[model samples]
Target chain A: MSARAETLPATGLRLPRLGLPSLDALGAWTLALIWIAPLVFAAWAAFHSPRDALAFDITAPWTLDNFAAAWVAAPWLRYFFNTMMLVTTILAGQLVLCTLAGYAFARFAFPGREVLFYLVLLQLFILPEVLIVENYVIVSRLGLFDTILGIGAPYMASAFGIFLLRQAFKQVPKELEEAARVEGCGWLGVLWRVYIPAAKPVYLAYALVSVATHWNNFLWPLVVTNSTTTRPLTVGLSLFAAPESGVNIAVISAATLMSIAPLLVAFLIFQRQFLQAFLRAGIR
Target chain B: MSDTDSLDRRRMALYGWMLLAPALILLTTFAFLPTVTTVWQSLFSRGTARRPAEFIGAENYQYLFDDPVFWQVATNNLIYAGVTIPVSIVIALGMALWANGHLPGRGFIRAAYFTPTMLPMIAAANLWLFFYTPSIGLIDRIAGLFGIGATNWLGQPETALWAIIIVTIWKEAGFFMIFYLAALQTIPPDLREAAVIEGASRWTYTRRIVLPLLMPTTLFVMINAMINSVKLIDHLFILTKGGPNNASKLLLYWIWETAFSYFDRPTAAALTVMVLAVLGLVAVFQFRGLEKRIHYR
Candidate 1:
């Protein structure tokens, strides 16, 4: 634990204290720059005219025309709305279903519980994307084709969510639940008051992960959605910049920026919190 | 008293079933049912307007086995997985080591490494599209500096999949880095102090102690990277669409095209079963072979 806090020593007990510290820092910085270069280039290209963008001119005049063109070229606002609804619907559904299922698996000693739990765990391997062909047929058969609900429905019952919530709930002290029961709370009441609150951090962590995941999800939505009204930002961006569309590189960059802006902005703003949330989620 | 206890047990069972019902229903509908149906469907001939579906046991499999495109796509997927998994894991480990050390602006470096993971693969693809575009693109421009003429990147079959592989490695390495970072933080500092007391070289200490400790993380990251190589085809949609005579085509993308684009459902189902089998094997290997050796604590 103490080692966890120690900022790894710069030049101690390693390599005879050669003046390699600066070189290491330089290497780290260079790698960081390389990692960020694409995004930096995207921003630059997105803000400049196509000619200037192609010319790689640092002195190019900045303009919003590319964004304007990108905005008018597609139904981006509708796509954004669809994505929001899709993620929200999936998140809400996952919360309810996973919470109930996780609680049962955590606390109840029912026959076949272990088998059922393992069955649910199997979903961790059988991702919805893997079953897209049949799922598409099922969705169309159920008349959910091209609908936001259809796009999100298949992912609503997340195995990862159930697993995470189960872990969180199991860690909760029994005394709290007993105390809630002593206050005349029923099972549901105790769950709502005690377990859920105790697992607030876990919920927050899962929510961030779930949102980021669905927001960036593309293939299933692309397959399910046929129109602008149903397509999410990722699918929309893909179609908008598709080679056949012949859209200029600048406009494509601008549209790419627009599509990723919300999550990207949120991520940049809440860098520490976002990273902490992911760490707490323990996805690996 | 025994009767009352039995009744209580029954009640608890009922409550548990009730709680599990919603998740089970959704999972069955989406995952379990689809898996079974995909396999079942693969054994039948695809239905057409003029001809109703018929039993065609192993026919679709026979066709897939004979299909050159299927072989090509499978080979491409193998190469994709083979390259992306090892490359990303290595780069991720490097990123983790850098970020975990006393580097200047570690937070910014870490964030920079991770930002690609947060972006949609579509957006990343779009950004890279311009970079890979020949003649007018960034790569060609950079190459021209060395008197090298334009080289078609995503246009050429030889370079297309490799280009896509690079983008995936960039996108994935940062994500795996976080896992390594988490694992790194757990190593006790006393070990480092003891190494120093023993006058061990940094390389020797890292190779002997740190690398060994990170083996579990490496395996964990490796499994995840393997799974991701199979699932992550989003960038392909924008980058190449498995183009250049299906040179860059992967199994999933090929399945999508066969089913949706060509309306060849049976073939797609057959391909999907292959995917499921691969994934099932991976799951078995992970759970049975590796799980025991993984040092969770």
Candidate 2:
């Protein structure tokens, strides 16, 4: 509408221009600046000496010493490995469990299906975080304490994943399943050939959401894992940057950047995919 | 023929149960059974070196009702929710409008707005911790230019929770903006054209046409924002540890401290039950109240 009003000039009378620069654009740019300032500051402080970082010297010499110090201060490589293992374990578990459950709900004719489905949906509200007290006891009683599996166990069967995949599988054309079955495919073969292939996009969207979530999870892992061998990057970064450790600001910023760098870099590279993934997964 | 039909029916049922077993076991273990156990455990006394575990019905609830710290933490959480939810939603709407419009550098602006959501809450806390540090903190340094003296942002009782609230808003607004942006794109362009032809002012168009159309999305976002108010307490672990006499303590953090830090298991169970009750109320309100409104619209 604004574009049409500007270009056509159909009316003889002229109206005042809204502004020299569009106020909408100006406001957006300002907000963007405020939003990005913390990240920009982190980058600036991480590259310079502590004195230079505090001084905000524009012409100061940049050095890698902060990164070196940060690396030596914590066992970051192990933390990274742990986070990767944790995310992979949770994602793989969720895909298999949710796919099977969703397929059963979407296709099977069973008694009490509606009630059972509602029970599954209840997990969406009663998240594991809310059940932390009893969940801790359950994890320990299973003799999985202080292990990576303990951290990943409670979240392996995701209700959100099951809900999404159920929606996707329901949209699959019935003829395709019958065709696969007619070609001498059994139930498992039909699922592998038809339903799974049809729901690839949903799987991808759910995978992105799940990866980002488990990668950033902190409290449960902090409770379950007692050693550096199992602590993910977020918990490790928190402990490393704790004020009781007496780490300086420059090195702390460097360590913070290291912790978030993988997700940050992945987002920047696949910005469109990341945005679309959220939109797809969230709209339901 | 009848025997074959019955056999097929039994086989189908078996397949269904086999497929559902894994997810049902997990959900029961992690979510459903734990909720029941939390309530059950709250009825028992915390066993220690001196005494065996015994059921003491309503004692924990009575204690929680009388505990001053529990009351204070609950109040703090309410204030935290009251401030963060509305402020973040409004900012997110503004961001979505800008990002969805004919703005210069739209891609960069949208990305800049959303970068915070991509970063972990713990990392965000680490970055902001530098900003809130007294004297040497960037905020104090900037204020120093105007001859204002250094003020303790995180150390003092008065300013600490507000400082945490500011960080929470910063981290969340961008995330909510994505949902708003998605909704904005789904709005038909013809509605704006019709409003323009009718000489509706921009504000009027937005107020009358756009907002009503976005009501469902707003309700959805509101529920998400509510859930986040309870979920995103990771930053507290880094920033304050609910410190300065528990001025910044939230309900979940208090639960953690009670159970893990103090080894008061029954009290923590009671607190957990309270948190669950609050969440359940919100869920019921959303489903019964707001959902009807959305459907009517």
Candidate 3:
């Protein structure tokens, strides 16, 4: 109010520019710093000796000892391999299944199509996590329990992916599909030749979202997998950093940061695509 | 020609069903069948070596109603949703506005806010575990600078849930911000200019012109947040294990504890049925609300 009054004293008309933009900037930066503080603190502790980490010694020399200790403390390499496999498997299955279903919904006129679409959409709310008990039993019955496939199976038929691809395919001009059909292409050939190419951006967006989701996923994997060979980074890290493990703070920090390093680096490198992908996915 | 066209139509319908088969199969096996099985299983009693499971209609749910831990966990989850959803959405709106505006280093600020979303929840909980560690933790160290004594943030019942709540908000608000930012970009700059031309203050322009346009995105983010509150409990495994007398325990976490840890599948199934009921309500609400949004568009 004081700033406004002072700025308006001459002509009694203060434009928005002279008001509190700078203060708003300050608030934004402050919140940003607070948002990033945990990561910064984790980096600080992970790079320093345990005593130095606890001491808040800004001048302390950074070392790799914590990383070394954390490395030896767990089978993170195997966990990483499991997570990569899990994410890729889910993406592969989702792409095939969603594209086929989405193409059907978009281009084909079939009895009960509306009912089937609504049924698929219902899966969006009745997610795998809520049905963990029965899913666990089902995986066990299929003899898939304790495997990566077991962890990935429930999520392979992604409702969001199907929905997004359906939207993408619907936007394709009828002329393109008709032209492909004129060339004597069957449904599969036309879908492969035209709709799939047109929906590449949607594929990337769905892939990014799916990989991030499954990579960070913990609960289902934690319940399904028993050994280090199948446990993803999240489950491994949880056990590694569990209070019962008695690991030190710096080492735990090192392990935690290492677990997220791959996804974090990919996100940083493709930051624009990541943001755009999420934006596109959300707006859908 | 009519006969051939009829043949083609039948063929097309057949191809469509074939195309949908794989997805429908997987969805039924995982989603639809599990839903029915969960409800059915909830009605039966937990089986044992000496006693085969028997149907005990409404007994498991009745037991859940009588269990104090169940009540506490349900209440904690409600508080979790009640606080995290609105608080994150409001912060997300502020973030979207600031990030979308002319703030310097806006890219870096936006990235900073979103980096956590890329992180695994367990990793996030591990990072917070350090700060919430008593005395030597960062929060206490900072408080120490102010001559304040140490406090156990996660070890006590009173602060444990609130501590968990803060992590949830920090982890979620940034993700929600992306939706708001997307919605914000779609708003025409001409509206703002016209408002300014009418002598509207910045606050007035934002309140009148900006917010109402973002309602659909708000509802979208709210549904996402609601689903997240139910599913995103990986941090609980790391931070509290719903510890210090079950203060921070959420329904899903308790369900996990019952089914896996205690091997009481019947009770867990009952709890899941309740969660399913809640999500069903959300689905109906969302579909209806989304239909209205589409109508508006």
Best by lDDT: 3
DockQ of each: 0.68, 0.55, 0.55
Question: Between prediction 1 and prediction 3, which has the larger lDDT?
Answer: 3
Q: For residues B1-297, write the lDDT of model 2, one tens digit per residue.
A: 999998888888789888999999999999999999999999999998899879999999999889898888888899899999999999999999888876668899999999999888999998897789898888999999999999899888898899889899999899899898999888787777677678877788788987888887888888888888888888999889998899999988888888899988899999999889988877786657544765898
lDDT tens digits by residue: candidate 1, B51-130: 99999999999999998988899999999999999999989988888888876688899999999999999999998987
Chain B TM-score for candidate 3: 0.97
lDDT for each residue of candidate 2 in A1-284, tens digit (9 for 90 to 100): 65676532311112336666656667889999999989999898999999899888879999999999999999999999999999999999999999999999998878878789878877877878877888999999999888888899899888889989998999999999999988999888988999999999889889998999888998889888889999999999989988898999899999999999999999999999999898889887
| TM-score against native, each model | 0.96, 0.95, 0.96
- List, residue by residue over A100-145, the lDDT tens digit for candidate 1: 9999999888999987877887787787888889999999999999
C-alpha lDDT of all candidate models, in order: 0.89, 0.88, 0.91
Off by over 4 Å in 2: A1-19, B1-10, B289-297
User: What's model 3's TM-score?
Assistant: 0.96
Evaluated at residue A86, the lDDT of candidate 3 is 97
* Least accurate 10 contiguous residues by lDDT in model 2 chain B: B285-294
In candidate 3 chain A, where is summed lDDT lowest over 10 consecutive residues? A6-15
- Candidate 3 on B1-297: residue-level lDDT in tens? 999999989998999999999999999999999999999999999999999999999999999999899889999999999999999999999999888876678889999989999999999999998899999999999999999999999999999999999999999999999999888888776676566468888778778878999888988999999999998898998889998999999989998899999999999999999999999999999989867768998
> Over the full model, what C-alpha lDDT does candidate 3 score relative to the true structure?
0.91
